[model samples]
Target: MTRNVARNRSPFSIWLAVISLCTAGLVGTYVLFVEAPPPRRIVIATGGKDGAYYRFAQLYANLLKSEGITLEVRSTQGSVENLKLLMDDDSDVRVAFVQTGIANSEQCDSLEALASLYREPLWIFYRGSKGIDRLTQLKQQRIAIGPEGSGTRGIALQLLKANGLGEKDDEFSALAGNLAAEALERGEIDVAFFVAGVDAKYVRKLLRDPEIHLAELTHAEAYERQFRFLSAVKIDEGLLDLQQNIPSHQIVLIAPAATLVAHRSLHPALVSLLLKVATKVHQQGDLLSNVGEFPSPKLTDLPLNPEAERYFRSGPPVLQRFMPFWLASMLDRLKIMIIPLIMLLMPLMRVAPPLVRWQTRRKIYLWYAELRRIDLRSIDGMTIEEADSSLEHLHRLEQQIARIGVPLSYMEEYYNLRLHLNLVRSRVLSILRGEAGHSQPGSHPGFRTEGGESTLAR
Candidate 1:
């Protein structure tokens, strides 16, 4: 009974071992893949509230809100200020609409571009058709080159330096947007350099003004070649207004793309969410771009984010395409655990059942060793008393064999062990009969065994 009780733990212990292996694999997988959840709220630096950057940022914020993220818009002076906010390590602005050329390679170490959303045209408006078609023509003139630290100032300064404008001092007005346009109307500045979208109120107003002429950049292709970030755009005549023939002729201009940039340390999940928002907000065409031309990963201002690179290369992961954004993101994180979990389970599944069967077979096979010992003992020549002793021992062995328990699958082996026991019993009984026959002279040979069976006849 003690042996049976002790041996019964084999199957239970094996199962426990399988459970432990599964648990350890799961824990290791979880450790490797689990990460802090993406921030629920974030801030983006958009340019002036009335500008295109701010307008498009609102669209991003609106779409992000549907995904359970709060988008706070931090308005700044322009793209230069936006870039500064993104570069600041202590700032909360993780995203911004940055102009392509405003930041240099050295300053972009901590910045990454999610995509280029649209073109931010550099519009040069002046008081006359001086046919002023080049950057060198307005060197010493009183010009409104937007405010200090604005994208307009950045591009204008670069162009001035490239064109050999030696005294690039405040020969320029520090005005921008409506103020610059108002100044141009009042003849306060001879020329105004405004970097804005095609639909900007001031840009449209300046374009229609009869006194102000939009300068046609004749060397646009050269500028594009020199500054790789610039793309030469052709604005066809009458495209803006058919009846009025606004501009009255085709105009060529050089412009930089408006990039959606973020800090390098921004969370990857948040990056994924921002990419989706970019697609929703900027996938359509504007006056200059064709439909689905923007929100492109190509020629972005800052280094392209790794996730954005993969997204543009092969598209979103399958889960993201079919499931909700948050749901798919969570599943993506958990996906790393699947292979390890399966690896742990497969071996346990393959080995455990066979191990249990071998353990059960051991229980039955152990009795065969005992049966062989008893069968050998029965063949020894012995007196009637020895024969009676051997018969009693065999009877006790049969009782134990009957008590052996096994599963339904092992029942055949269980019964087979008992049959062998009975065969050994018959051999012992024959020896007892032979001994009793030889000692028939003793009257006391009519002895009874433990079960009240008299041994006189057999």
Candidate 2:
């Protein structure tokens, strides 16, 4: 009984396997053709650990960690070094915050901007009893333009050169950040230049100091025109500290926008994720920027990424609207494959059912053809011995059909074939009993012995 059951299921099992293999092949092909999954981890180059770039990068790392991505933040000297890490093909760095004008077209061919995050004002603090209104007045004084490879130094040199100072000038110093602030306070440097956010602790602390004065750029609009990336921004009176009136008056400043930049080949989904986090981090209004002014699609030194452009224009990808980050990312990767897989399977689905039906019917019909051959011999003049052999052949064909397994839909045909076999067997036996001459042609429902000819009745 067990053997019979196994035999009954054999054809279905074979066909099921065939269908399974075809499905597997399609899935494998899609996996091979689709884009590789986004990296599970990425590295970002930021400025010194105490600067705004490093602080904001840490915030991004926390946000990305919640989405199952590991964001490794590497602290560098500043924007100049950040650009170096991004441009190096051998480096693992994929993202960084770079200041505008720090990178030029020749240096940033392999990089793209996600968005401009915020404005970094160039603050020049001088210790003086008399006001210093221009870069030219401080040309001969010892000045801290930040350390080498820092964005502050890069922009300071540009501004200083416009006022006739250069590498030939022996009065330039290389102090930076807290060090630069300290040098000015201690009178080691007569002037200190800092490029940083208004909210930076050092900048706020220096603004409150009575001895140090924040020099206002009298020709801020001219500087903005000279350097297209620079914007003329104003520090309103009493905005920093209402009680102390830190600036004591409205101050005009020239600033460059800080941009979130990445390698040109960074994954599109990751680009979107970074942009989303940037908007959350920098959308608030500060002294220089109005609310929602940043994460702006403002063109910077690096060309804007196409994905970042689309995201700013239309919002997040459609799948990401309702799903969690990891699931949305997986679906976005797989979305390209959906249409191609559908194109492949539709025609197969249309033809598969009929092909199966024909296969099952053919199994039953083949034995009927054999039965017809034996029936024809009985009519075409077989003797008693030949009739006996034909009868035994018909019985063997019957046993074969009985053991064969087919779907229930084909059972009617199976039984009808068996009924025809029985009719032919009866006629063959009659011939063996010497009674073939008495039976009229066409008398049997399934067999036709007229003119000693056989017809396939199925």
Candidate 3:
């Protein structure tokens, strides 16, 4: 009996599976193309662990960690190497700290600036007897301009070229950090160019050295004019160490802002979050910048990301301002798909009722096609052998229909179909008995066999 019912609904079940697959396919396509979730992990390229970029990146990492994101701060040579990592298509690095004016025109199309982080003052320390107030005063002296693929080297060359100095490899050295400081003390190098924060170790070492004098750059505003990325920042007297009375007097210096940058394909959610992080990390008052001044859009050379631009113009996302970052991001990613999902569901809702009705009635009405086929052929004047065969087919069909189970709502259809099938069976039996009324067919619903007083009907 169970096998008979399984045979009845087998076609309907196959159709159901096909429709289910099609529906699943549509939703999968929507998720894969229209509205996908952002990655939970991100990679950021920064300078060496001792540099300001890596330190700032760690602060950013801590804040992002609270939001369920893993920010990997990968240390590199410097901004030049960081930019290369971001530009490489196969590289997983998406975010990095880049100095203003470090990216060239050809590379500008692939990257975007989130915000200007902080001022990295260009500190030039020389071992000469008299303080060299201007860049042109030092001629053919050994200069430590940092290593290749370092932002310090890029900026040092630009500054040196601007001062009417030639770029000869023999004239310049790649020494940096302790090497540059030690070389200066041993007179191996006459000058060392460094772009770093006040907290950097090398910058601090040079500042405390009495023999190495800081070059008082003349025409600080003129350098800012020549390089759009440069800004004139003032160092107040004893700002680094007030207890030791360092700097002796206040002096103006040219500086470049370290900008937080990302590739063009980085997720917008991350960009918005990073903007919020920049506010918390760099908005506080520092030595060179007042409160809320460091992360400003000023002094940034790369084109601003759309999300970052909006964030600076307004504020953090409305959802993020009040709720937890993870929850807020989830809601934002789903908001776009809400309408599309509703649109996809509407068709399924409409077609479901008719499809269900067909499946239910199919369980009962299926016998009708076979019942009608047997009744049409079993007519008056048929041979006894044909009449017995037709009657046998009708009995088999009636047995098959009896085993089918349907919902309570469809029980009425089930019983009515049984009645039609019975009438057809009675006609075939009456024909087999050769009754008087067996000459003509009946007129009941789904019954078109002979109208005869059947022995079974009796």
Number of the top-ranking candidate, with lDDT as the measure:
2
Residue 341, candidate 1: alpha-carbon lDDT: 84
Model 2, position 201, has a per-residue lDDT of 83
lDDT of 3 by residue, 112-139 (tens): 8888988989999999679788888778
Which prediction has more favorable lDDT, 1 or 2? 2
Q: Write the per-residue lDDT of candidate 1 for residues 139-209, one digit (tens) a residue.
A: 67898887767888888888888987644454877898998899999998899988888888888888888
Off by over 4 Å in 3: 1-4, 10-21, 27-45, 57-76, 84-95, 127-131, 140-142, 168-171, 185-189, 263-285, 291-296, 306-344, 370-394, 425-458
Supply candidate 1's per-residue lDDT for 337: 80
TM-score of each: 0.77, 0.89, 0.75
Better of 1 and 2 by TM-score: 2
Clashing pairs in 2: none
C-alpha RMSD of each candidate structure in angstroms? 5.2, 6.4, 6.5
Candidate 3 local accuracy as lDDT?
0.81
lDDT of each: 0.81, 0.82, 0.81
Residue pairs of candidate 3 with colliding backbone atoms:
441-449
What's the lDDT of the predicted structure labeled candidate 1? 0.81
Residues 1-458 of candidate 2 have per-residue lDDT tens digits of 01222333334644575577567866886678768778889999999999999999999999889888899999999988888999998999999989898889775788888899889999999998879889888867898987778899899998998898887874888899998898888889899999998888889998988899988878999999889889998888988888998678888999998899999889888999888888888889587888988888884876889999999899988877788778998888877677766765676666667767777777777676678788788779787567766776776676677888887978899899889989998887666545434445454333456467543232
